[model samples]
Target: MRAGTSPNSSSCSAWRSEAGPGVRCSCPRPRGGSANSISTTDVPVLPNAGDYTIGVSIGTPPQPLLLNLDTGSDLVWTQCQPCLSCFNQRFPLYDPSQSSTYSPLACSSKLCRALPLSACHAQCLYLYGYGDNSIAIGTLASEAFTFGSSNNVTVPNLGFGCGFLNGGLFNNESGIAGFGRGSLSLISQLGVGKFSYCFISYDDDDSKSSTLMLGSAADLNGSATAVRSTPFVLNPSQPTFYYLSLDGITVGTTRLPIPKSAFVLQRNGTGGVIIDSGTAITQLTTVAYKLVRSAFLSQVKPPVANATAEVFDLCFSLPSSPSAKVDVPKLIFHFEGADMDLPHENYMYQDSTVGLMCLAMFDSGDESSTIGNFQQQNMHVVYDLDNQKLSFAPARCDQL
Candidate 1:
């Protein structure tokens, strides 16, 4: 999911500031070429199911954080000391006082240049917004980072945010472990080289869980489908964005018949189908949005009127008739290289009122769309940078 100040808030402009002298921006700018072009790499054709999760550590004891495997962000941050208003979770807090290696970034430091602040004062603070309307703000600093299941490897001098206070869903989260491509992010710092993959599971309920693979590939159950990888545009001035050549979308067996021009690439550099674990719902463009929602409602028997929520564009009554079977066609997400099909559970939800409802499942706040946790459930998603491709495999998250 994308993070910044509120859409209407003037304070949100902090994301565009320029770095001062000698300080370098972590995001890589486009090198003057066609935007959608993929770099030269060996596109490994592997069977779906070899999905794995990347292990992210938060706090001093380094509690293992299971993230949704996102490619849209770069800075990996977590909750820390003085978390007076935080939510319930198993992770520990990072106490800045305890680590002798902890060093706050100077206002004039290159890292602070791109952030929105009145001045390059070392006292500036950074904050992030969540879907649940939670906010986390803190000073930026360099600390130690360790990855892997054995927890044997460690990377020192890692730049991360140490949030002292956070609001909303963030209170429940340790902090965000960003997986965007940049020098400040885990993938960039570990020298693991470019390319990592993520495997997400599809679950209708809490049973869903997924994996993120760093500098390696996870073991898929051998039923994975490979999709073409679109080049990532790293906007040096703002957050990173993942760009995929989305040809079209299909509901079950029927194609929505929407034009390809509807889904345009974002120009701000940070544009594309942003994959995020922290967000519970998925956001889509207006055209793709209408088609997906219409197809979902058509499948459910006894048509229900759309309900209004602050975020979601459409919601339907749970399918009632026991004889009424919701035949969700394999929702096909057509990228340039391969077409990926999502199972029924990805869009259908059993609600408290409506027994089963076809959820539009996403929101586009302004205009951009996001692929959040709800869509990632019950599927193994692989982000292979080495081969410049993305892969997917279905999983039994009901067992999670």
Candidate 2:
């Protein structure tokens, strides 16, 4: 999950106020099965909140593991034995020696070719970067990764990164487990055709408790608001990206027309309005950025200056008034034949630094409008890989 409120009790109320409404869904849970019978539940649906934990395993015995979940990247690496230097977290590092199933892919392997042995070597030797400059690096190997309660499983020769050193805000975590669409990614290797991940945040006090689901739709508890699957453009040699034809953005009853150039379509492996569970804040282009920021700031009280150089255009001071409120005009994303309407809170939050500075929920520095964990707090996001479509539904994200 994104960083929490600063270590100050004064701003506690502000944080809770900014949480908006929680999300809850009623999707069915998964049932265990064999490799051939591996249904949705057998697929790994790693969590992207709290200390950045997800499930993984090492060796033929398949010891359960929980590592950070990252979508920007496509590789699912884990810590291995003989880790000279590695960061500490809740889970134990994978000891390759103990795992009879562990095997390193040769330099000639297709996975190595796609990532380029050179890049793989760098990742193995250096640090992996995360939001807020968090970094970690580890080795790569093949192992059994189990999912669901009974642990119906799939054993693939996956790339595991054992992060030894870290800096900035990620010191509290262990290592990263990438969920991107690259050949090195766990999903690609597992042969789980298409799957979707839904994030449901716990109470503001327990942001770390937010849950993530994979493969099946068991964890999601919302009506299926399906939309046409837009073709996800794969960067050939690079990882895959989800792409959608964004016709326009709407706020309330007003539709803001942004030039196609204003938004980058299918640049990264991600396409359409790419949703990144890793980023702390949402990101939008200049045109959509200005429009959304202006509308929010106009309705709220006096404006606050941008906090960091990468801060959004508008921010609200949370502690000043009787909970400042603004009508967040629904921002609608127009796809090919369907228009998805997003709740105002999806892009509005109370600034942690400033007591009452409610701002347009996302930052402006990222290349695309990444729908981060904060925006995904109480929503069910569907990724239809086979059909090449995506869907969304409102939810109440609360602890069970």
Candidate 3:
């Protein structure tokens, strides 16, 4: 289910915007399977709207809904029955009463106090808000969570938000499955230790869905490639966010002349870099964007069209001939311990139907720099919380 809207959606502002296997998947279950073992061949994730969605079955009798998988947020919620203020959704609202496993949390429960913004009326009521002002206000409750349509795997007594009043640009996703590093997040509650996903390419029209690997399967897959790991930079004040050290960026062979301070995460938690699946495009700080914009434009071939958008600062016309190569230069991101030379399509969104090509990154002004899903297409990324590190390897996600 897609819920997040583009950052700075109202203006030129850069808008941008899992889990685990406590239980086994299709495989046989033990007290706990091997940490490196591929325990579940369970969930089927699809690219929905501009974001990604996965099938989640909640409740005892199994009520299924599509949920947005968000690494940027922490809270598993959906629009439940009795919507107080709900956005028009595509699927039927989740009816808690119909399920035998439904159980609301008490106000005094420690899980209810996990997030600072949560408040209690009679029971534990949570108020989850997004940077775009989208909010989900409802009760915090525990229910059985199942993955995949066949219901091969389930986690009983999983804590999640049952939204009664929710509104946002969800693209009709039922709600969100937050995979952030927060205690209340689905990933944390499941205690999967490690998880991984490979998003199907946006251009892949075959309509095939990808898998969300948990436990040892993700790590074993990592062992096969030219994988590189980067330590997660912690912001003590805001621990839920997965921050990384971005060393620098390069256009072709020339590194932009941006200051190192541009990417720093201050004590107040103002600016830093995060890998977000909710956002469609990459977003950079104003200081870095200006230098990168200048560098990219300086290298493009002459006769470039003056195409532009409210969010993206760079745009150009693609050659009319189908066989002609788009002359966009190679863009590279220098992370703390690795350099990712993005596929041409990853950094540049080529809307061939309109013969337009725009740089996939947005200028996020003074806000945090976001490595959105656009830059992560056809990329297999693994999050190892036990080691507190992030790893990546380029892959044909359609096949994964």
Candidate 4:
């Protein structure tokens, strides 16, 4: 996001001034960030299985629903009425009929045209798929979206997918709130070029919540910080995914001997490292994974190990209790211009259900590397889309 212009004032005024009447503005009172700059809205993070979800309301009366804040894809969608197939959800499905503000987009609409593979059948239909094979096939509709605790701040006529047929590992959440760099994404729709998020350790107290800020508040300027930023690589072919230049990783002081080209963008516009909030575990290329895994084992030597968890590559029994701290060294991710030192808890997970400690990273072959949300915990990460850079600063996420 660009700095200086306040989302609550100048930028918002510019946005609303362009739109004609009957469009209700729902801008919130700007919270102070640096005693002068507006602080970002803090949305409570709800723990769903291993994923982190935030509350979002849609429709006329603002029906409350929880959705995953995914940065990988671009489509803010929720399970709607007339489902052919859907996951068992904690909340009721969103019924567009109940909301007077809800309106379906036409096939010729600009929003529908922005979609990658939009289908026209009276209503603009869309088929959104995830890397996990989760598919959401539904109609594209626009409605008022309310965010934050008071639910007073809203974005009217926001484009979202009303998923009539959806299936995924969405445990209790309704659907995903896309923050990617696509035309129909919330970020693009709002025209806020900047956003930042601070994630807390999932295994920690559930009482504490994570934070996501939009607009000028997401800027690193006029703040006390140790922020490092790197240029974001945008592939015209895959615009939704935010690709970062990852040189190599370091276990404490020793940096791994991985080839630079191993993390480079391939001829197919793939094979670069991505910072994904939806993926629970971090994934590395096969060759890079082996080197890091071996380095981790040599440093953190745990005893009485067991079989790896269904997803995690490394798992071991805690010596004494679940709270017992493992002497794991800090994992430093060496990006092109930034060196993010991940805390021990950020890279390791303690399964409270089974009382086992495991490395929360895996090898997903040589397709592409991913820096998952787990590794992003306790870090103030700022995504500056306008500048095409990402900045990071280590902090206690709970405190932030």
Candidate 5:
């Protein structure tokens, strides 16, 4: 979910750059020690579900919640008690009154001023709308947030939203644990040097798990997995996002002729490529995406089908026989310093409704493009904020 919800439903696009968190381009370095490492409860790809969820214990007595790991947006919040318009969640709503340490932030507080659209009554209140028009309106407050199940790490005065009027892309997961480059994001608050996560491909399997490591424990040098690193480019206007430099893309071995300027970040901070965890599929600028599509259509023999699938633009019919197979071309994403050669499974997904093989990427229609989670399967991505670089290693992540 690049990931409070689906790829089509994102809060990042809805975010106004002027209202974003004041973040430094230099980045924050981590203090020593394992801040926390959470073993997530996986709810793999289901009929209409395929987003990552991590557990957190919020408030005094510790109301356990499963939150989406969203690096795309800022603000870590959960649905609180007396939810005036809450969505259906699996766990009980958090009651701030029951917690001994819960307190609402004052309207005059610095935290309240960090947001773009905020109104202060007696308490700091906010109304966040996503690009898909999803809304979460609630009061801003500080509470104790326990990080892990085993080696528990508690941050006693964490700033978060107490969502009372939440709607849109939100599903069963309580709320978003924001890891964006914003002052109010959990990553910014914890002052962690880095964070790392490896996602297994989404499937129907229920018992699978993955680990999210924060602070000093997020070191990539300690892992046996071979890795590559790419420098992180900044979007000053939209400091909440982690931007990347994409050189071009390769279909099989042939690198598509895409100008580097096509992926460049405008000085005003508008157009660029960002590797998002919340988006289910990758989205490339329309022009660049068309080139890739054209190359595939030219090489592949199967005729394109206008499949019943709603989201995907490229879907093709397979041979009638069960044993028949088609050679789906592999896609290699050329980042500034590293190349990610994804397997066939990573780029192509089967639409069970129509039995059509569909391309897992999208055409953004504008300059902004996103590298979604579908292509990141089995890749252990490390957001090394301390060094201002993104690194990855192909690993068997399901064991995490």
Candidate 6:
């Protein structure tokens, strides 16, 4: 599901916002599934807010709530009952009192120690601040989380944040369902050690939902198309972010003169490229972005004009009669061990009302870069934490 918000939200900073219980519970094995895998279908939600959201069922008597499927954060949280002050949410608030499985953590728990300057009282209370300045303050609890599967397999006593006060650019969604690499992340807690997802086109109005697979079934190597694999780097300082070694970028057959060192991981663990699902547009280093933009503009010479839209930097205005031919070049990201040849639809976004198409990428002021979700559409991407590798293969996500 797609939620609407500002297009520039792709720059949303990385990292989990709050701390929660490190508790984990075993989920029932899925039916007709492999001995080691469990798969969940994620519903795609499109609000006027422009953010990608999914419906998650939590509690003993399932209470459905919409949340952002974020890879950059680590804690799965939702606004709960007895909200002292909460943002306006579209979905119903989760009430722990109504569920027999809901269990709030104690202040002295080790999970609370994981949080920065966490405070304890009768119940374990936590505070999370997001990159966009959004804040959620509430209790850390564990409960049964039911994924959308044919058998409705449920993961009991899963740790999560129950927000009593939330404020930020949530776009009315309940909260965030983090899939980061931290111990409290969905993948880490479930002990899946691997996960994968494929996003459909953002313009696909008919896209009902997508699938996020956990365990062996998440592997994309089974595809007929050869899956390109790349080394996945891990930094202890920033455990939540997934770092990739991007050597350079190519427009069609031409490889731009981007220095390999520009993509190198810095000692601080901040200077490198990361694949993030929360961001909507790909962000490149200032040097890399300029080269890519210049090369693309030279190849596709549309009318010399600025984008009327605030979010995009490069845009093209078409003639009175829409032009059938828009020469968008292929974007291939040269990683350390693999190259991802992206489709045109991944790099270009069209505003039909204005007859304008913009490069759905941006320039990052710092050395760090982000490969946004838009560029990953219709592609099956696998994250194998156990093997410390990332792989991908092109596929029609909707049909998959």
Judging by TM-score against the true structure, name the best candidate: 3
| Reference-based lDDT, each prediction | 0.50, 0.51, 0.74, 0.75, 0.73, 0.73
Query: Cα miss at 243, model 3 (Å)?
Result: 0.3
In candidate 4 the C-alpha lDDT for residue 35 amounts to 16
Q: Which digits, one per residue and each the tens of the lDDT, describe model 3 over residues 182-256? A: 888878887788888888887676346677877766753535447888889898877778899998999978988
* 290-352: candidate 1 lDDT, tens digit per residue: 777777667645456466532345555544566655554577777766666766666655554
Among residues 3 or more apart in sequence or in different chains, the pairs in candidate 3 whose N, CA or C atoms overlap within 3 Å are: 1-67, 1-68, 1-173, 2-170, 3-170, 7-15, 7-16, 18-179, 36-216
User: Comparing 3 and 6 by TM-score, which wins?
Assistant: 3
For residues 138-226, what per-residue lDDT tens digits would candidate 4 score against the true structure? 99989877655422456678899999889877786789989999888878887887888877767666456655677776754325548
lDDT over C-alpha atoms for residue 281 of model 4: 84
- What would the TM-scores of all predictions be? 0.70, 0.73, 0.88, 0.85, 0.86, 0.86
lDDT score for residue 76 of model 4: 90
How many clashes (backbone N, Cα, C below 3 Å) per candidate? Answer: 46, 46, 9, 4, 8, 12
| Residue 386 shift from truth in candidate 2, angstroms | 1.2
- Tens digits of per-residue lDDT, candidate 5, 1-400, equal 2222221211121111111221111111111122333222111211115567666667665665667787888888888877888887755677788788799999998879987689989899998766558788999999877665334555678899999999988667778778899988888887778888888768735444566777766656436546888999988799889899999999966899998888999998888999877777888998899999888877767788885654788788876766777888879888988988888888888755566888888888899999888788887889999899999988767654
lDDT of the structure predicted as candidate 5: 0.73
Model 1 per-residue lDDT at 1: 14
Give candidate 6's whole-model lDDT.
0.73
Q: Which stretches of candidate 5 lie over 4 Å from their true place?
A: 1-48, 221-225
Provide the lDDT at 99 for model 6.
80
